[model samples]
Every structure is written in C-alpha cells, then in structure tokens.
Target: KSPQCTPDQHLQTQSETQGLESAQVTKPVEETLSSLSALLISATANPENVLIDALDRKVAFLVNFLLMKYRMKELVRKADIWKMIIQDDEDHFHEIFLRACEHMEMIFGLDVKEVDPTRHCYGISIKLGLTYDGMMHPPEGLPKTGLLILILAEIFMNDNCVSEEEVWKVLSKTKIYSGQMHFIYGHPKELVTKYLVMEKYLEYRQVADSDPARYEFLWGPRAHAEVRKMEILEFLARVHGTEPQSYPSQYEDALRDEE
Candidate 1:
C-alpha cells in the first residue's frame, strides 16, 4: 500500500495549493484594475479636447455657410446659423457666431456687419473700411482688401497722391505684375485701375499736363467717407510694430484730419 498521510499534512498541502492559485489569480485581477484606471483617466481627460474639436468644427461649418450666403448675395440671419450649427446649444450661439466672424475677418479679410438688428440679419463686407461689394465672385478668390489697404497707405504716404509707376514698383515687390492674371486677385492692373475705381474706393486720374498721359491715385469719396487718416496710420504703425505717433508728420496730419 502507499504511505499514509496525516490529516494535518493533507490539510496543509491543500492550503498551499489554494495559496498558489490565489497568487495566480491576483496578478490578472491587478492588471485588469490597472487597465481600468488608465481608461478612466483617459476618459476624464478627453472631454475638454472633444469639446474644443466640436467647437472648431461648428465654427468651420458656420464660416462656410456664411461664405455661401455672401457669395449668393443673401442676407445671413442669426436664426439660420443657430438652426444649422447651434441647434440645441442656444446659450453658445453668440460665442460661436463671434468666433465665425473673427475667423472671417482674420482669414478672409471680410466683415460680418449687422445690417438689421431687429431681424438679426447680417451682411458680409470687405474688411478695413470697405462697406461695398459683398460678391467676391467664385467664393474662393483670395481677398484683395489687403492690397487695397496697402495702396491707400501708399497714397497717404506720398503726399495724398501716388503715381502709377510708383504703385507698380510697390506692387512688384509683392510679386503682383500689372498685366498678369494673379491666382487670387485676377488682373492686378484692371483691379487697381478699374474695379476699385468703379467701387469708388480709389480715384485714378490723368496727371495734369503729363506728356505721356500719366495717372495718379488719390483717395476717392468712398474712402474719405468710410475711413479716417488716423485709422490708416494706426494700421501702418501696427504693421511696423510701432506707435502711430512715431511718424511725427503723418501722426500730426492724422490728428488734424481727425479734428
């Protein structure tokens, strides 16, 4: 017969086996617990990121919608934007709309102005003092507002009038040639000499008694009505990273113009 085991010995052996099984079981449980903890942390951290991403998507949608309305020459109603993007988030309508407007102005050089406060209707216009022409054809053309501003600034700098040659020289530095069709602003020559003139933002006229029939640019009636000298000076100063008063002559002239 096989050797007989004592009862205590059998009990001890059984307990040891159970202990080994317990050890084996504990490790996987601990690993599972750790994984769950990591998942919880990740879930907790993701809400803010998710919110930001959602907000950005909404703002983009609103921007594209606004651009579409502007291209179609339709009035933008606040209710429509709310319906499209902020359907249930009524509290965040203003915030989202503000962000969209800021994006339009900053990126596309466009402004969303409140055309009808009672009806909450808005209209798109070119930034930097252009309140006319909401139709930026093709809806994808790059804005010419910046170029217009630069031209206006040049005119202001050159004793309130700038010659065609001088303007072309300045534009050449920006890689904009006269006759070439630019990818953004179409033909620079026609844009400057015709469209802007027709818009009443620039006055291009033949210089008096020039044998070659030269032209000069001056601030048109619309420019005078829409923008002030000080505002342009401040814009230039901001570009140069200086105060508007740094240019003493222009500053004084701007001050007088303000008065």
Candidate 2:
C-alpha cells in the first residue's frame, strides 16, 4: 500500500521544509523519505514480490542520512540486519538501515516461543511492540510444559543446573500437581519433559550409565536467547520482596549443598 499522506499534507510539509511554495517538478526529501518507509513496510508484508531495488541510490542516501541523524548503531547490532543493505565496505550504512527497522519497532528481535508440547516443538517469534507486559504469564505461543521448564530455569538461574528429581519437586509445589495433574493424552509432568527435550529449551543429560540413569537439566539455547538472569532476579524481587543482593549468596549455598 502507498503512504496515507495526502498530496496537500505532503505539499504543506514540503513548503515548511523549503520555506517556499511547493512545486510539482521536484519532490521534497521529506515526501521521498515517507514514501520510502511505506514501500519498505509493504515489501516486508509481501515477501513474494518484495521490491528488490529498495537499496537503490536514492533510498540508500535517505536511509544513511536518517541513521546519521539518529545515532542508532548499537540497536542495529542487536536487530542483526547487516546482510540486507550491505554493499562494498559500506557496513556503517547497512547498520543504520537496520537500526531504523528496530527504532520503528517493525523488526524488534528474536524471542523463543513454545508452540506444541505434545509434539515437542517450539517456534521463534519476532518481538514487536512499544510496551512490555512484564513476564506475568507465559508468552502467547508457549505451552504449559514450556512454562514449567521456564519456571525451573528461573528457579535454578544461579546454579544453572537442576536434577530431574528436583524439577519434579518444584513442579509438585504448583497448583497443577494438587488439583489438575493430567493432560487429555498423558500426564502433565511427562509433557513438560517431552516439550523441554524436543525444543531443546532444557538440556537433559544422564548422570551415569545405569539401568535407570538419573538426569540433570540445564538451560538450553532457547532459554538463553529469551530469558535473562536480571529478569529472573527482578521478577523475584517484585513477587517475594526478595533482595537482589541475596541471590548470589543463596545460589552459592545451594551449589555447596548440592555438592
């Protein structure tokens, strides 16, 4: 879709920019930039026929100008869009284009989302929004099993490890264990194990080679990508009035006791 700005609006903006009456012969830089942004958004939404010449000289020049004015190189690094607009040794300009995407909140970043627990799979999500909801509930696509795994990860954030038995104990403390302990197809705890293993959201390794080997769980790639230590600490501080400073000491004690 084209830009929603009317011709009159564009003319007024152009006139303001030039301090002269708008002319039909020459388009103002502001109008060009707005049109470029609209085209980019449209291209993003329509992958099959995306405009390939988005990096043409005119668009590139405008993108570079905007980036330099905003000073947003670091956010571009986080968004990870270097390959899109990179040309020759013009790495600096590519980063600006990327940072613009992030600043607009059109392409925020990767977030891990659990899609199916019974099938044991997860999906990568693009985080997009101006406001955060605070991690009160599991993210939209996360399954119940994924939620349990995430809770276990947060609980063992300090030590970075938990035994299978300890995980069960933590799960038991939840209301699900008391009143609702079953899924339609199988048990809830088993679903948690399957989901975590399938998605690699939690690592499961045997402690020994035995008939019934004991296992330990650790945060996996998805967990590391999505959850942060500070997030867990902040959540605990808000919920339990727990001091953030106490975590390290408590974690140390737990580690020693585990040993």
Clashes of each: 0, 0
List the candidate 2 regions with Cα displacement exceeding 4 Å. 1-146, 154-158, 175-180, 183-186, 209-211, 249-259
Q: Candidate 2 lDDT, tens digit per residue, 6-109?
A: 23354345434222211110122224334444554554554476555544432444344333322321222222223444544364554444444322221112
Looking at candidate 2, what is the lDDT of residue 194? Answer: 59
Model 1, 54-81: lDDT tens digits are 5556666787788688667799998888
Instruction: Give the whole-model CA lDDT for all candidates, comma-separated.
Output: 0.65, 0.40
> Candidate 1: deviation at residue 187, Å?
1.1
- TM-score, model 1 to reference: 0.55
Record all residue pairs in model 2 with backbone atoms less than 3 Å apart, i.e. clashing.
none
Reference-based TM-score, model 2: 0.37
Q: What's model 1's lDDT at 120?
A: 91
| Clash list (residue pairs), candidate 1 | none
Lowest lDDT 10-residue stretch of candidate 2:
20-29
| Each prediction's TM-score versus the true structure | 0.55, 0.37
Candidate 1 local lDDT, residue 138: 22
Regions of model 1 farther than 4 Å from truth: 1-108, 111-125, 133-142
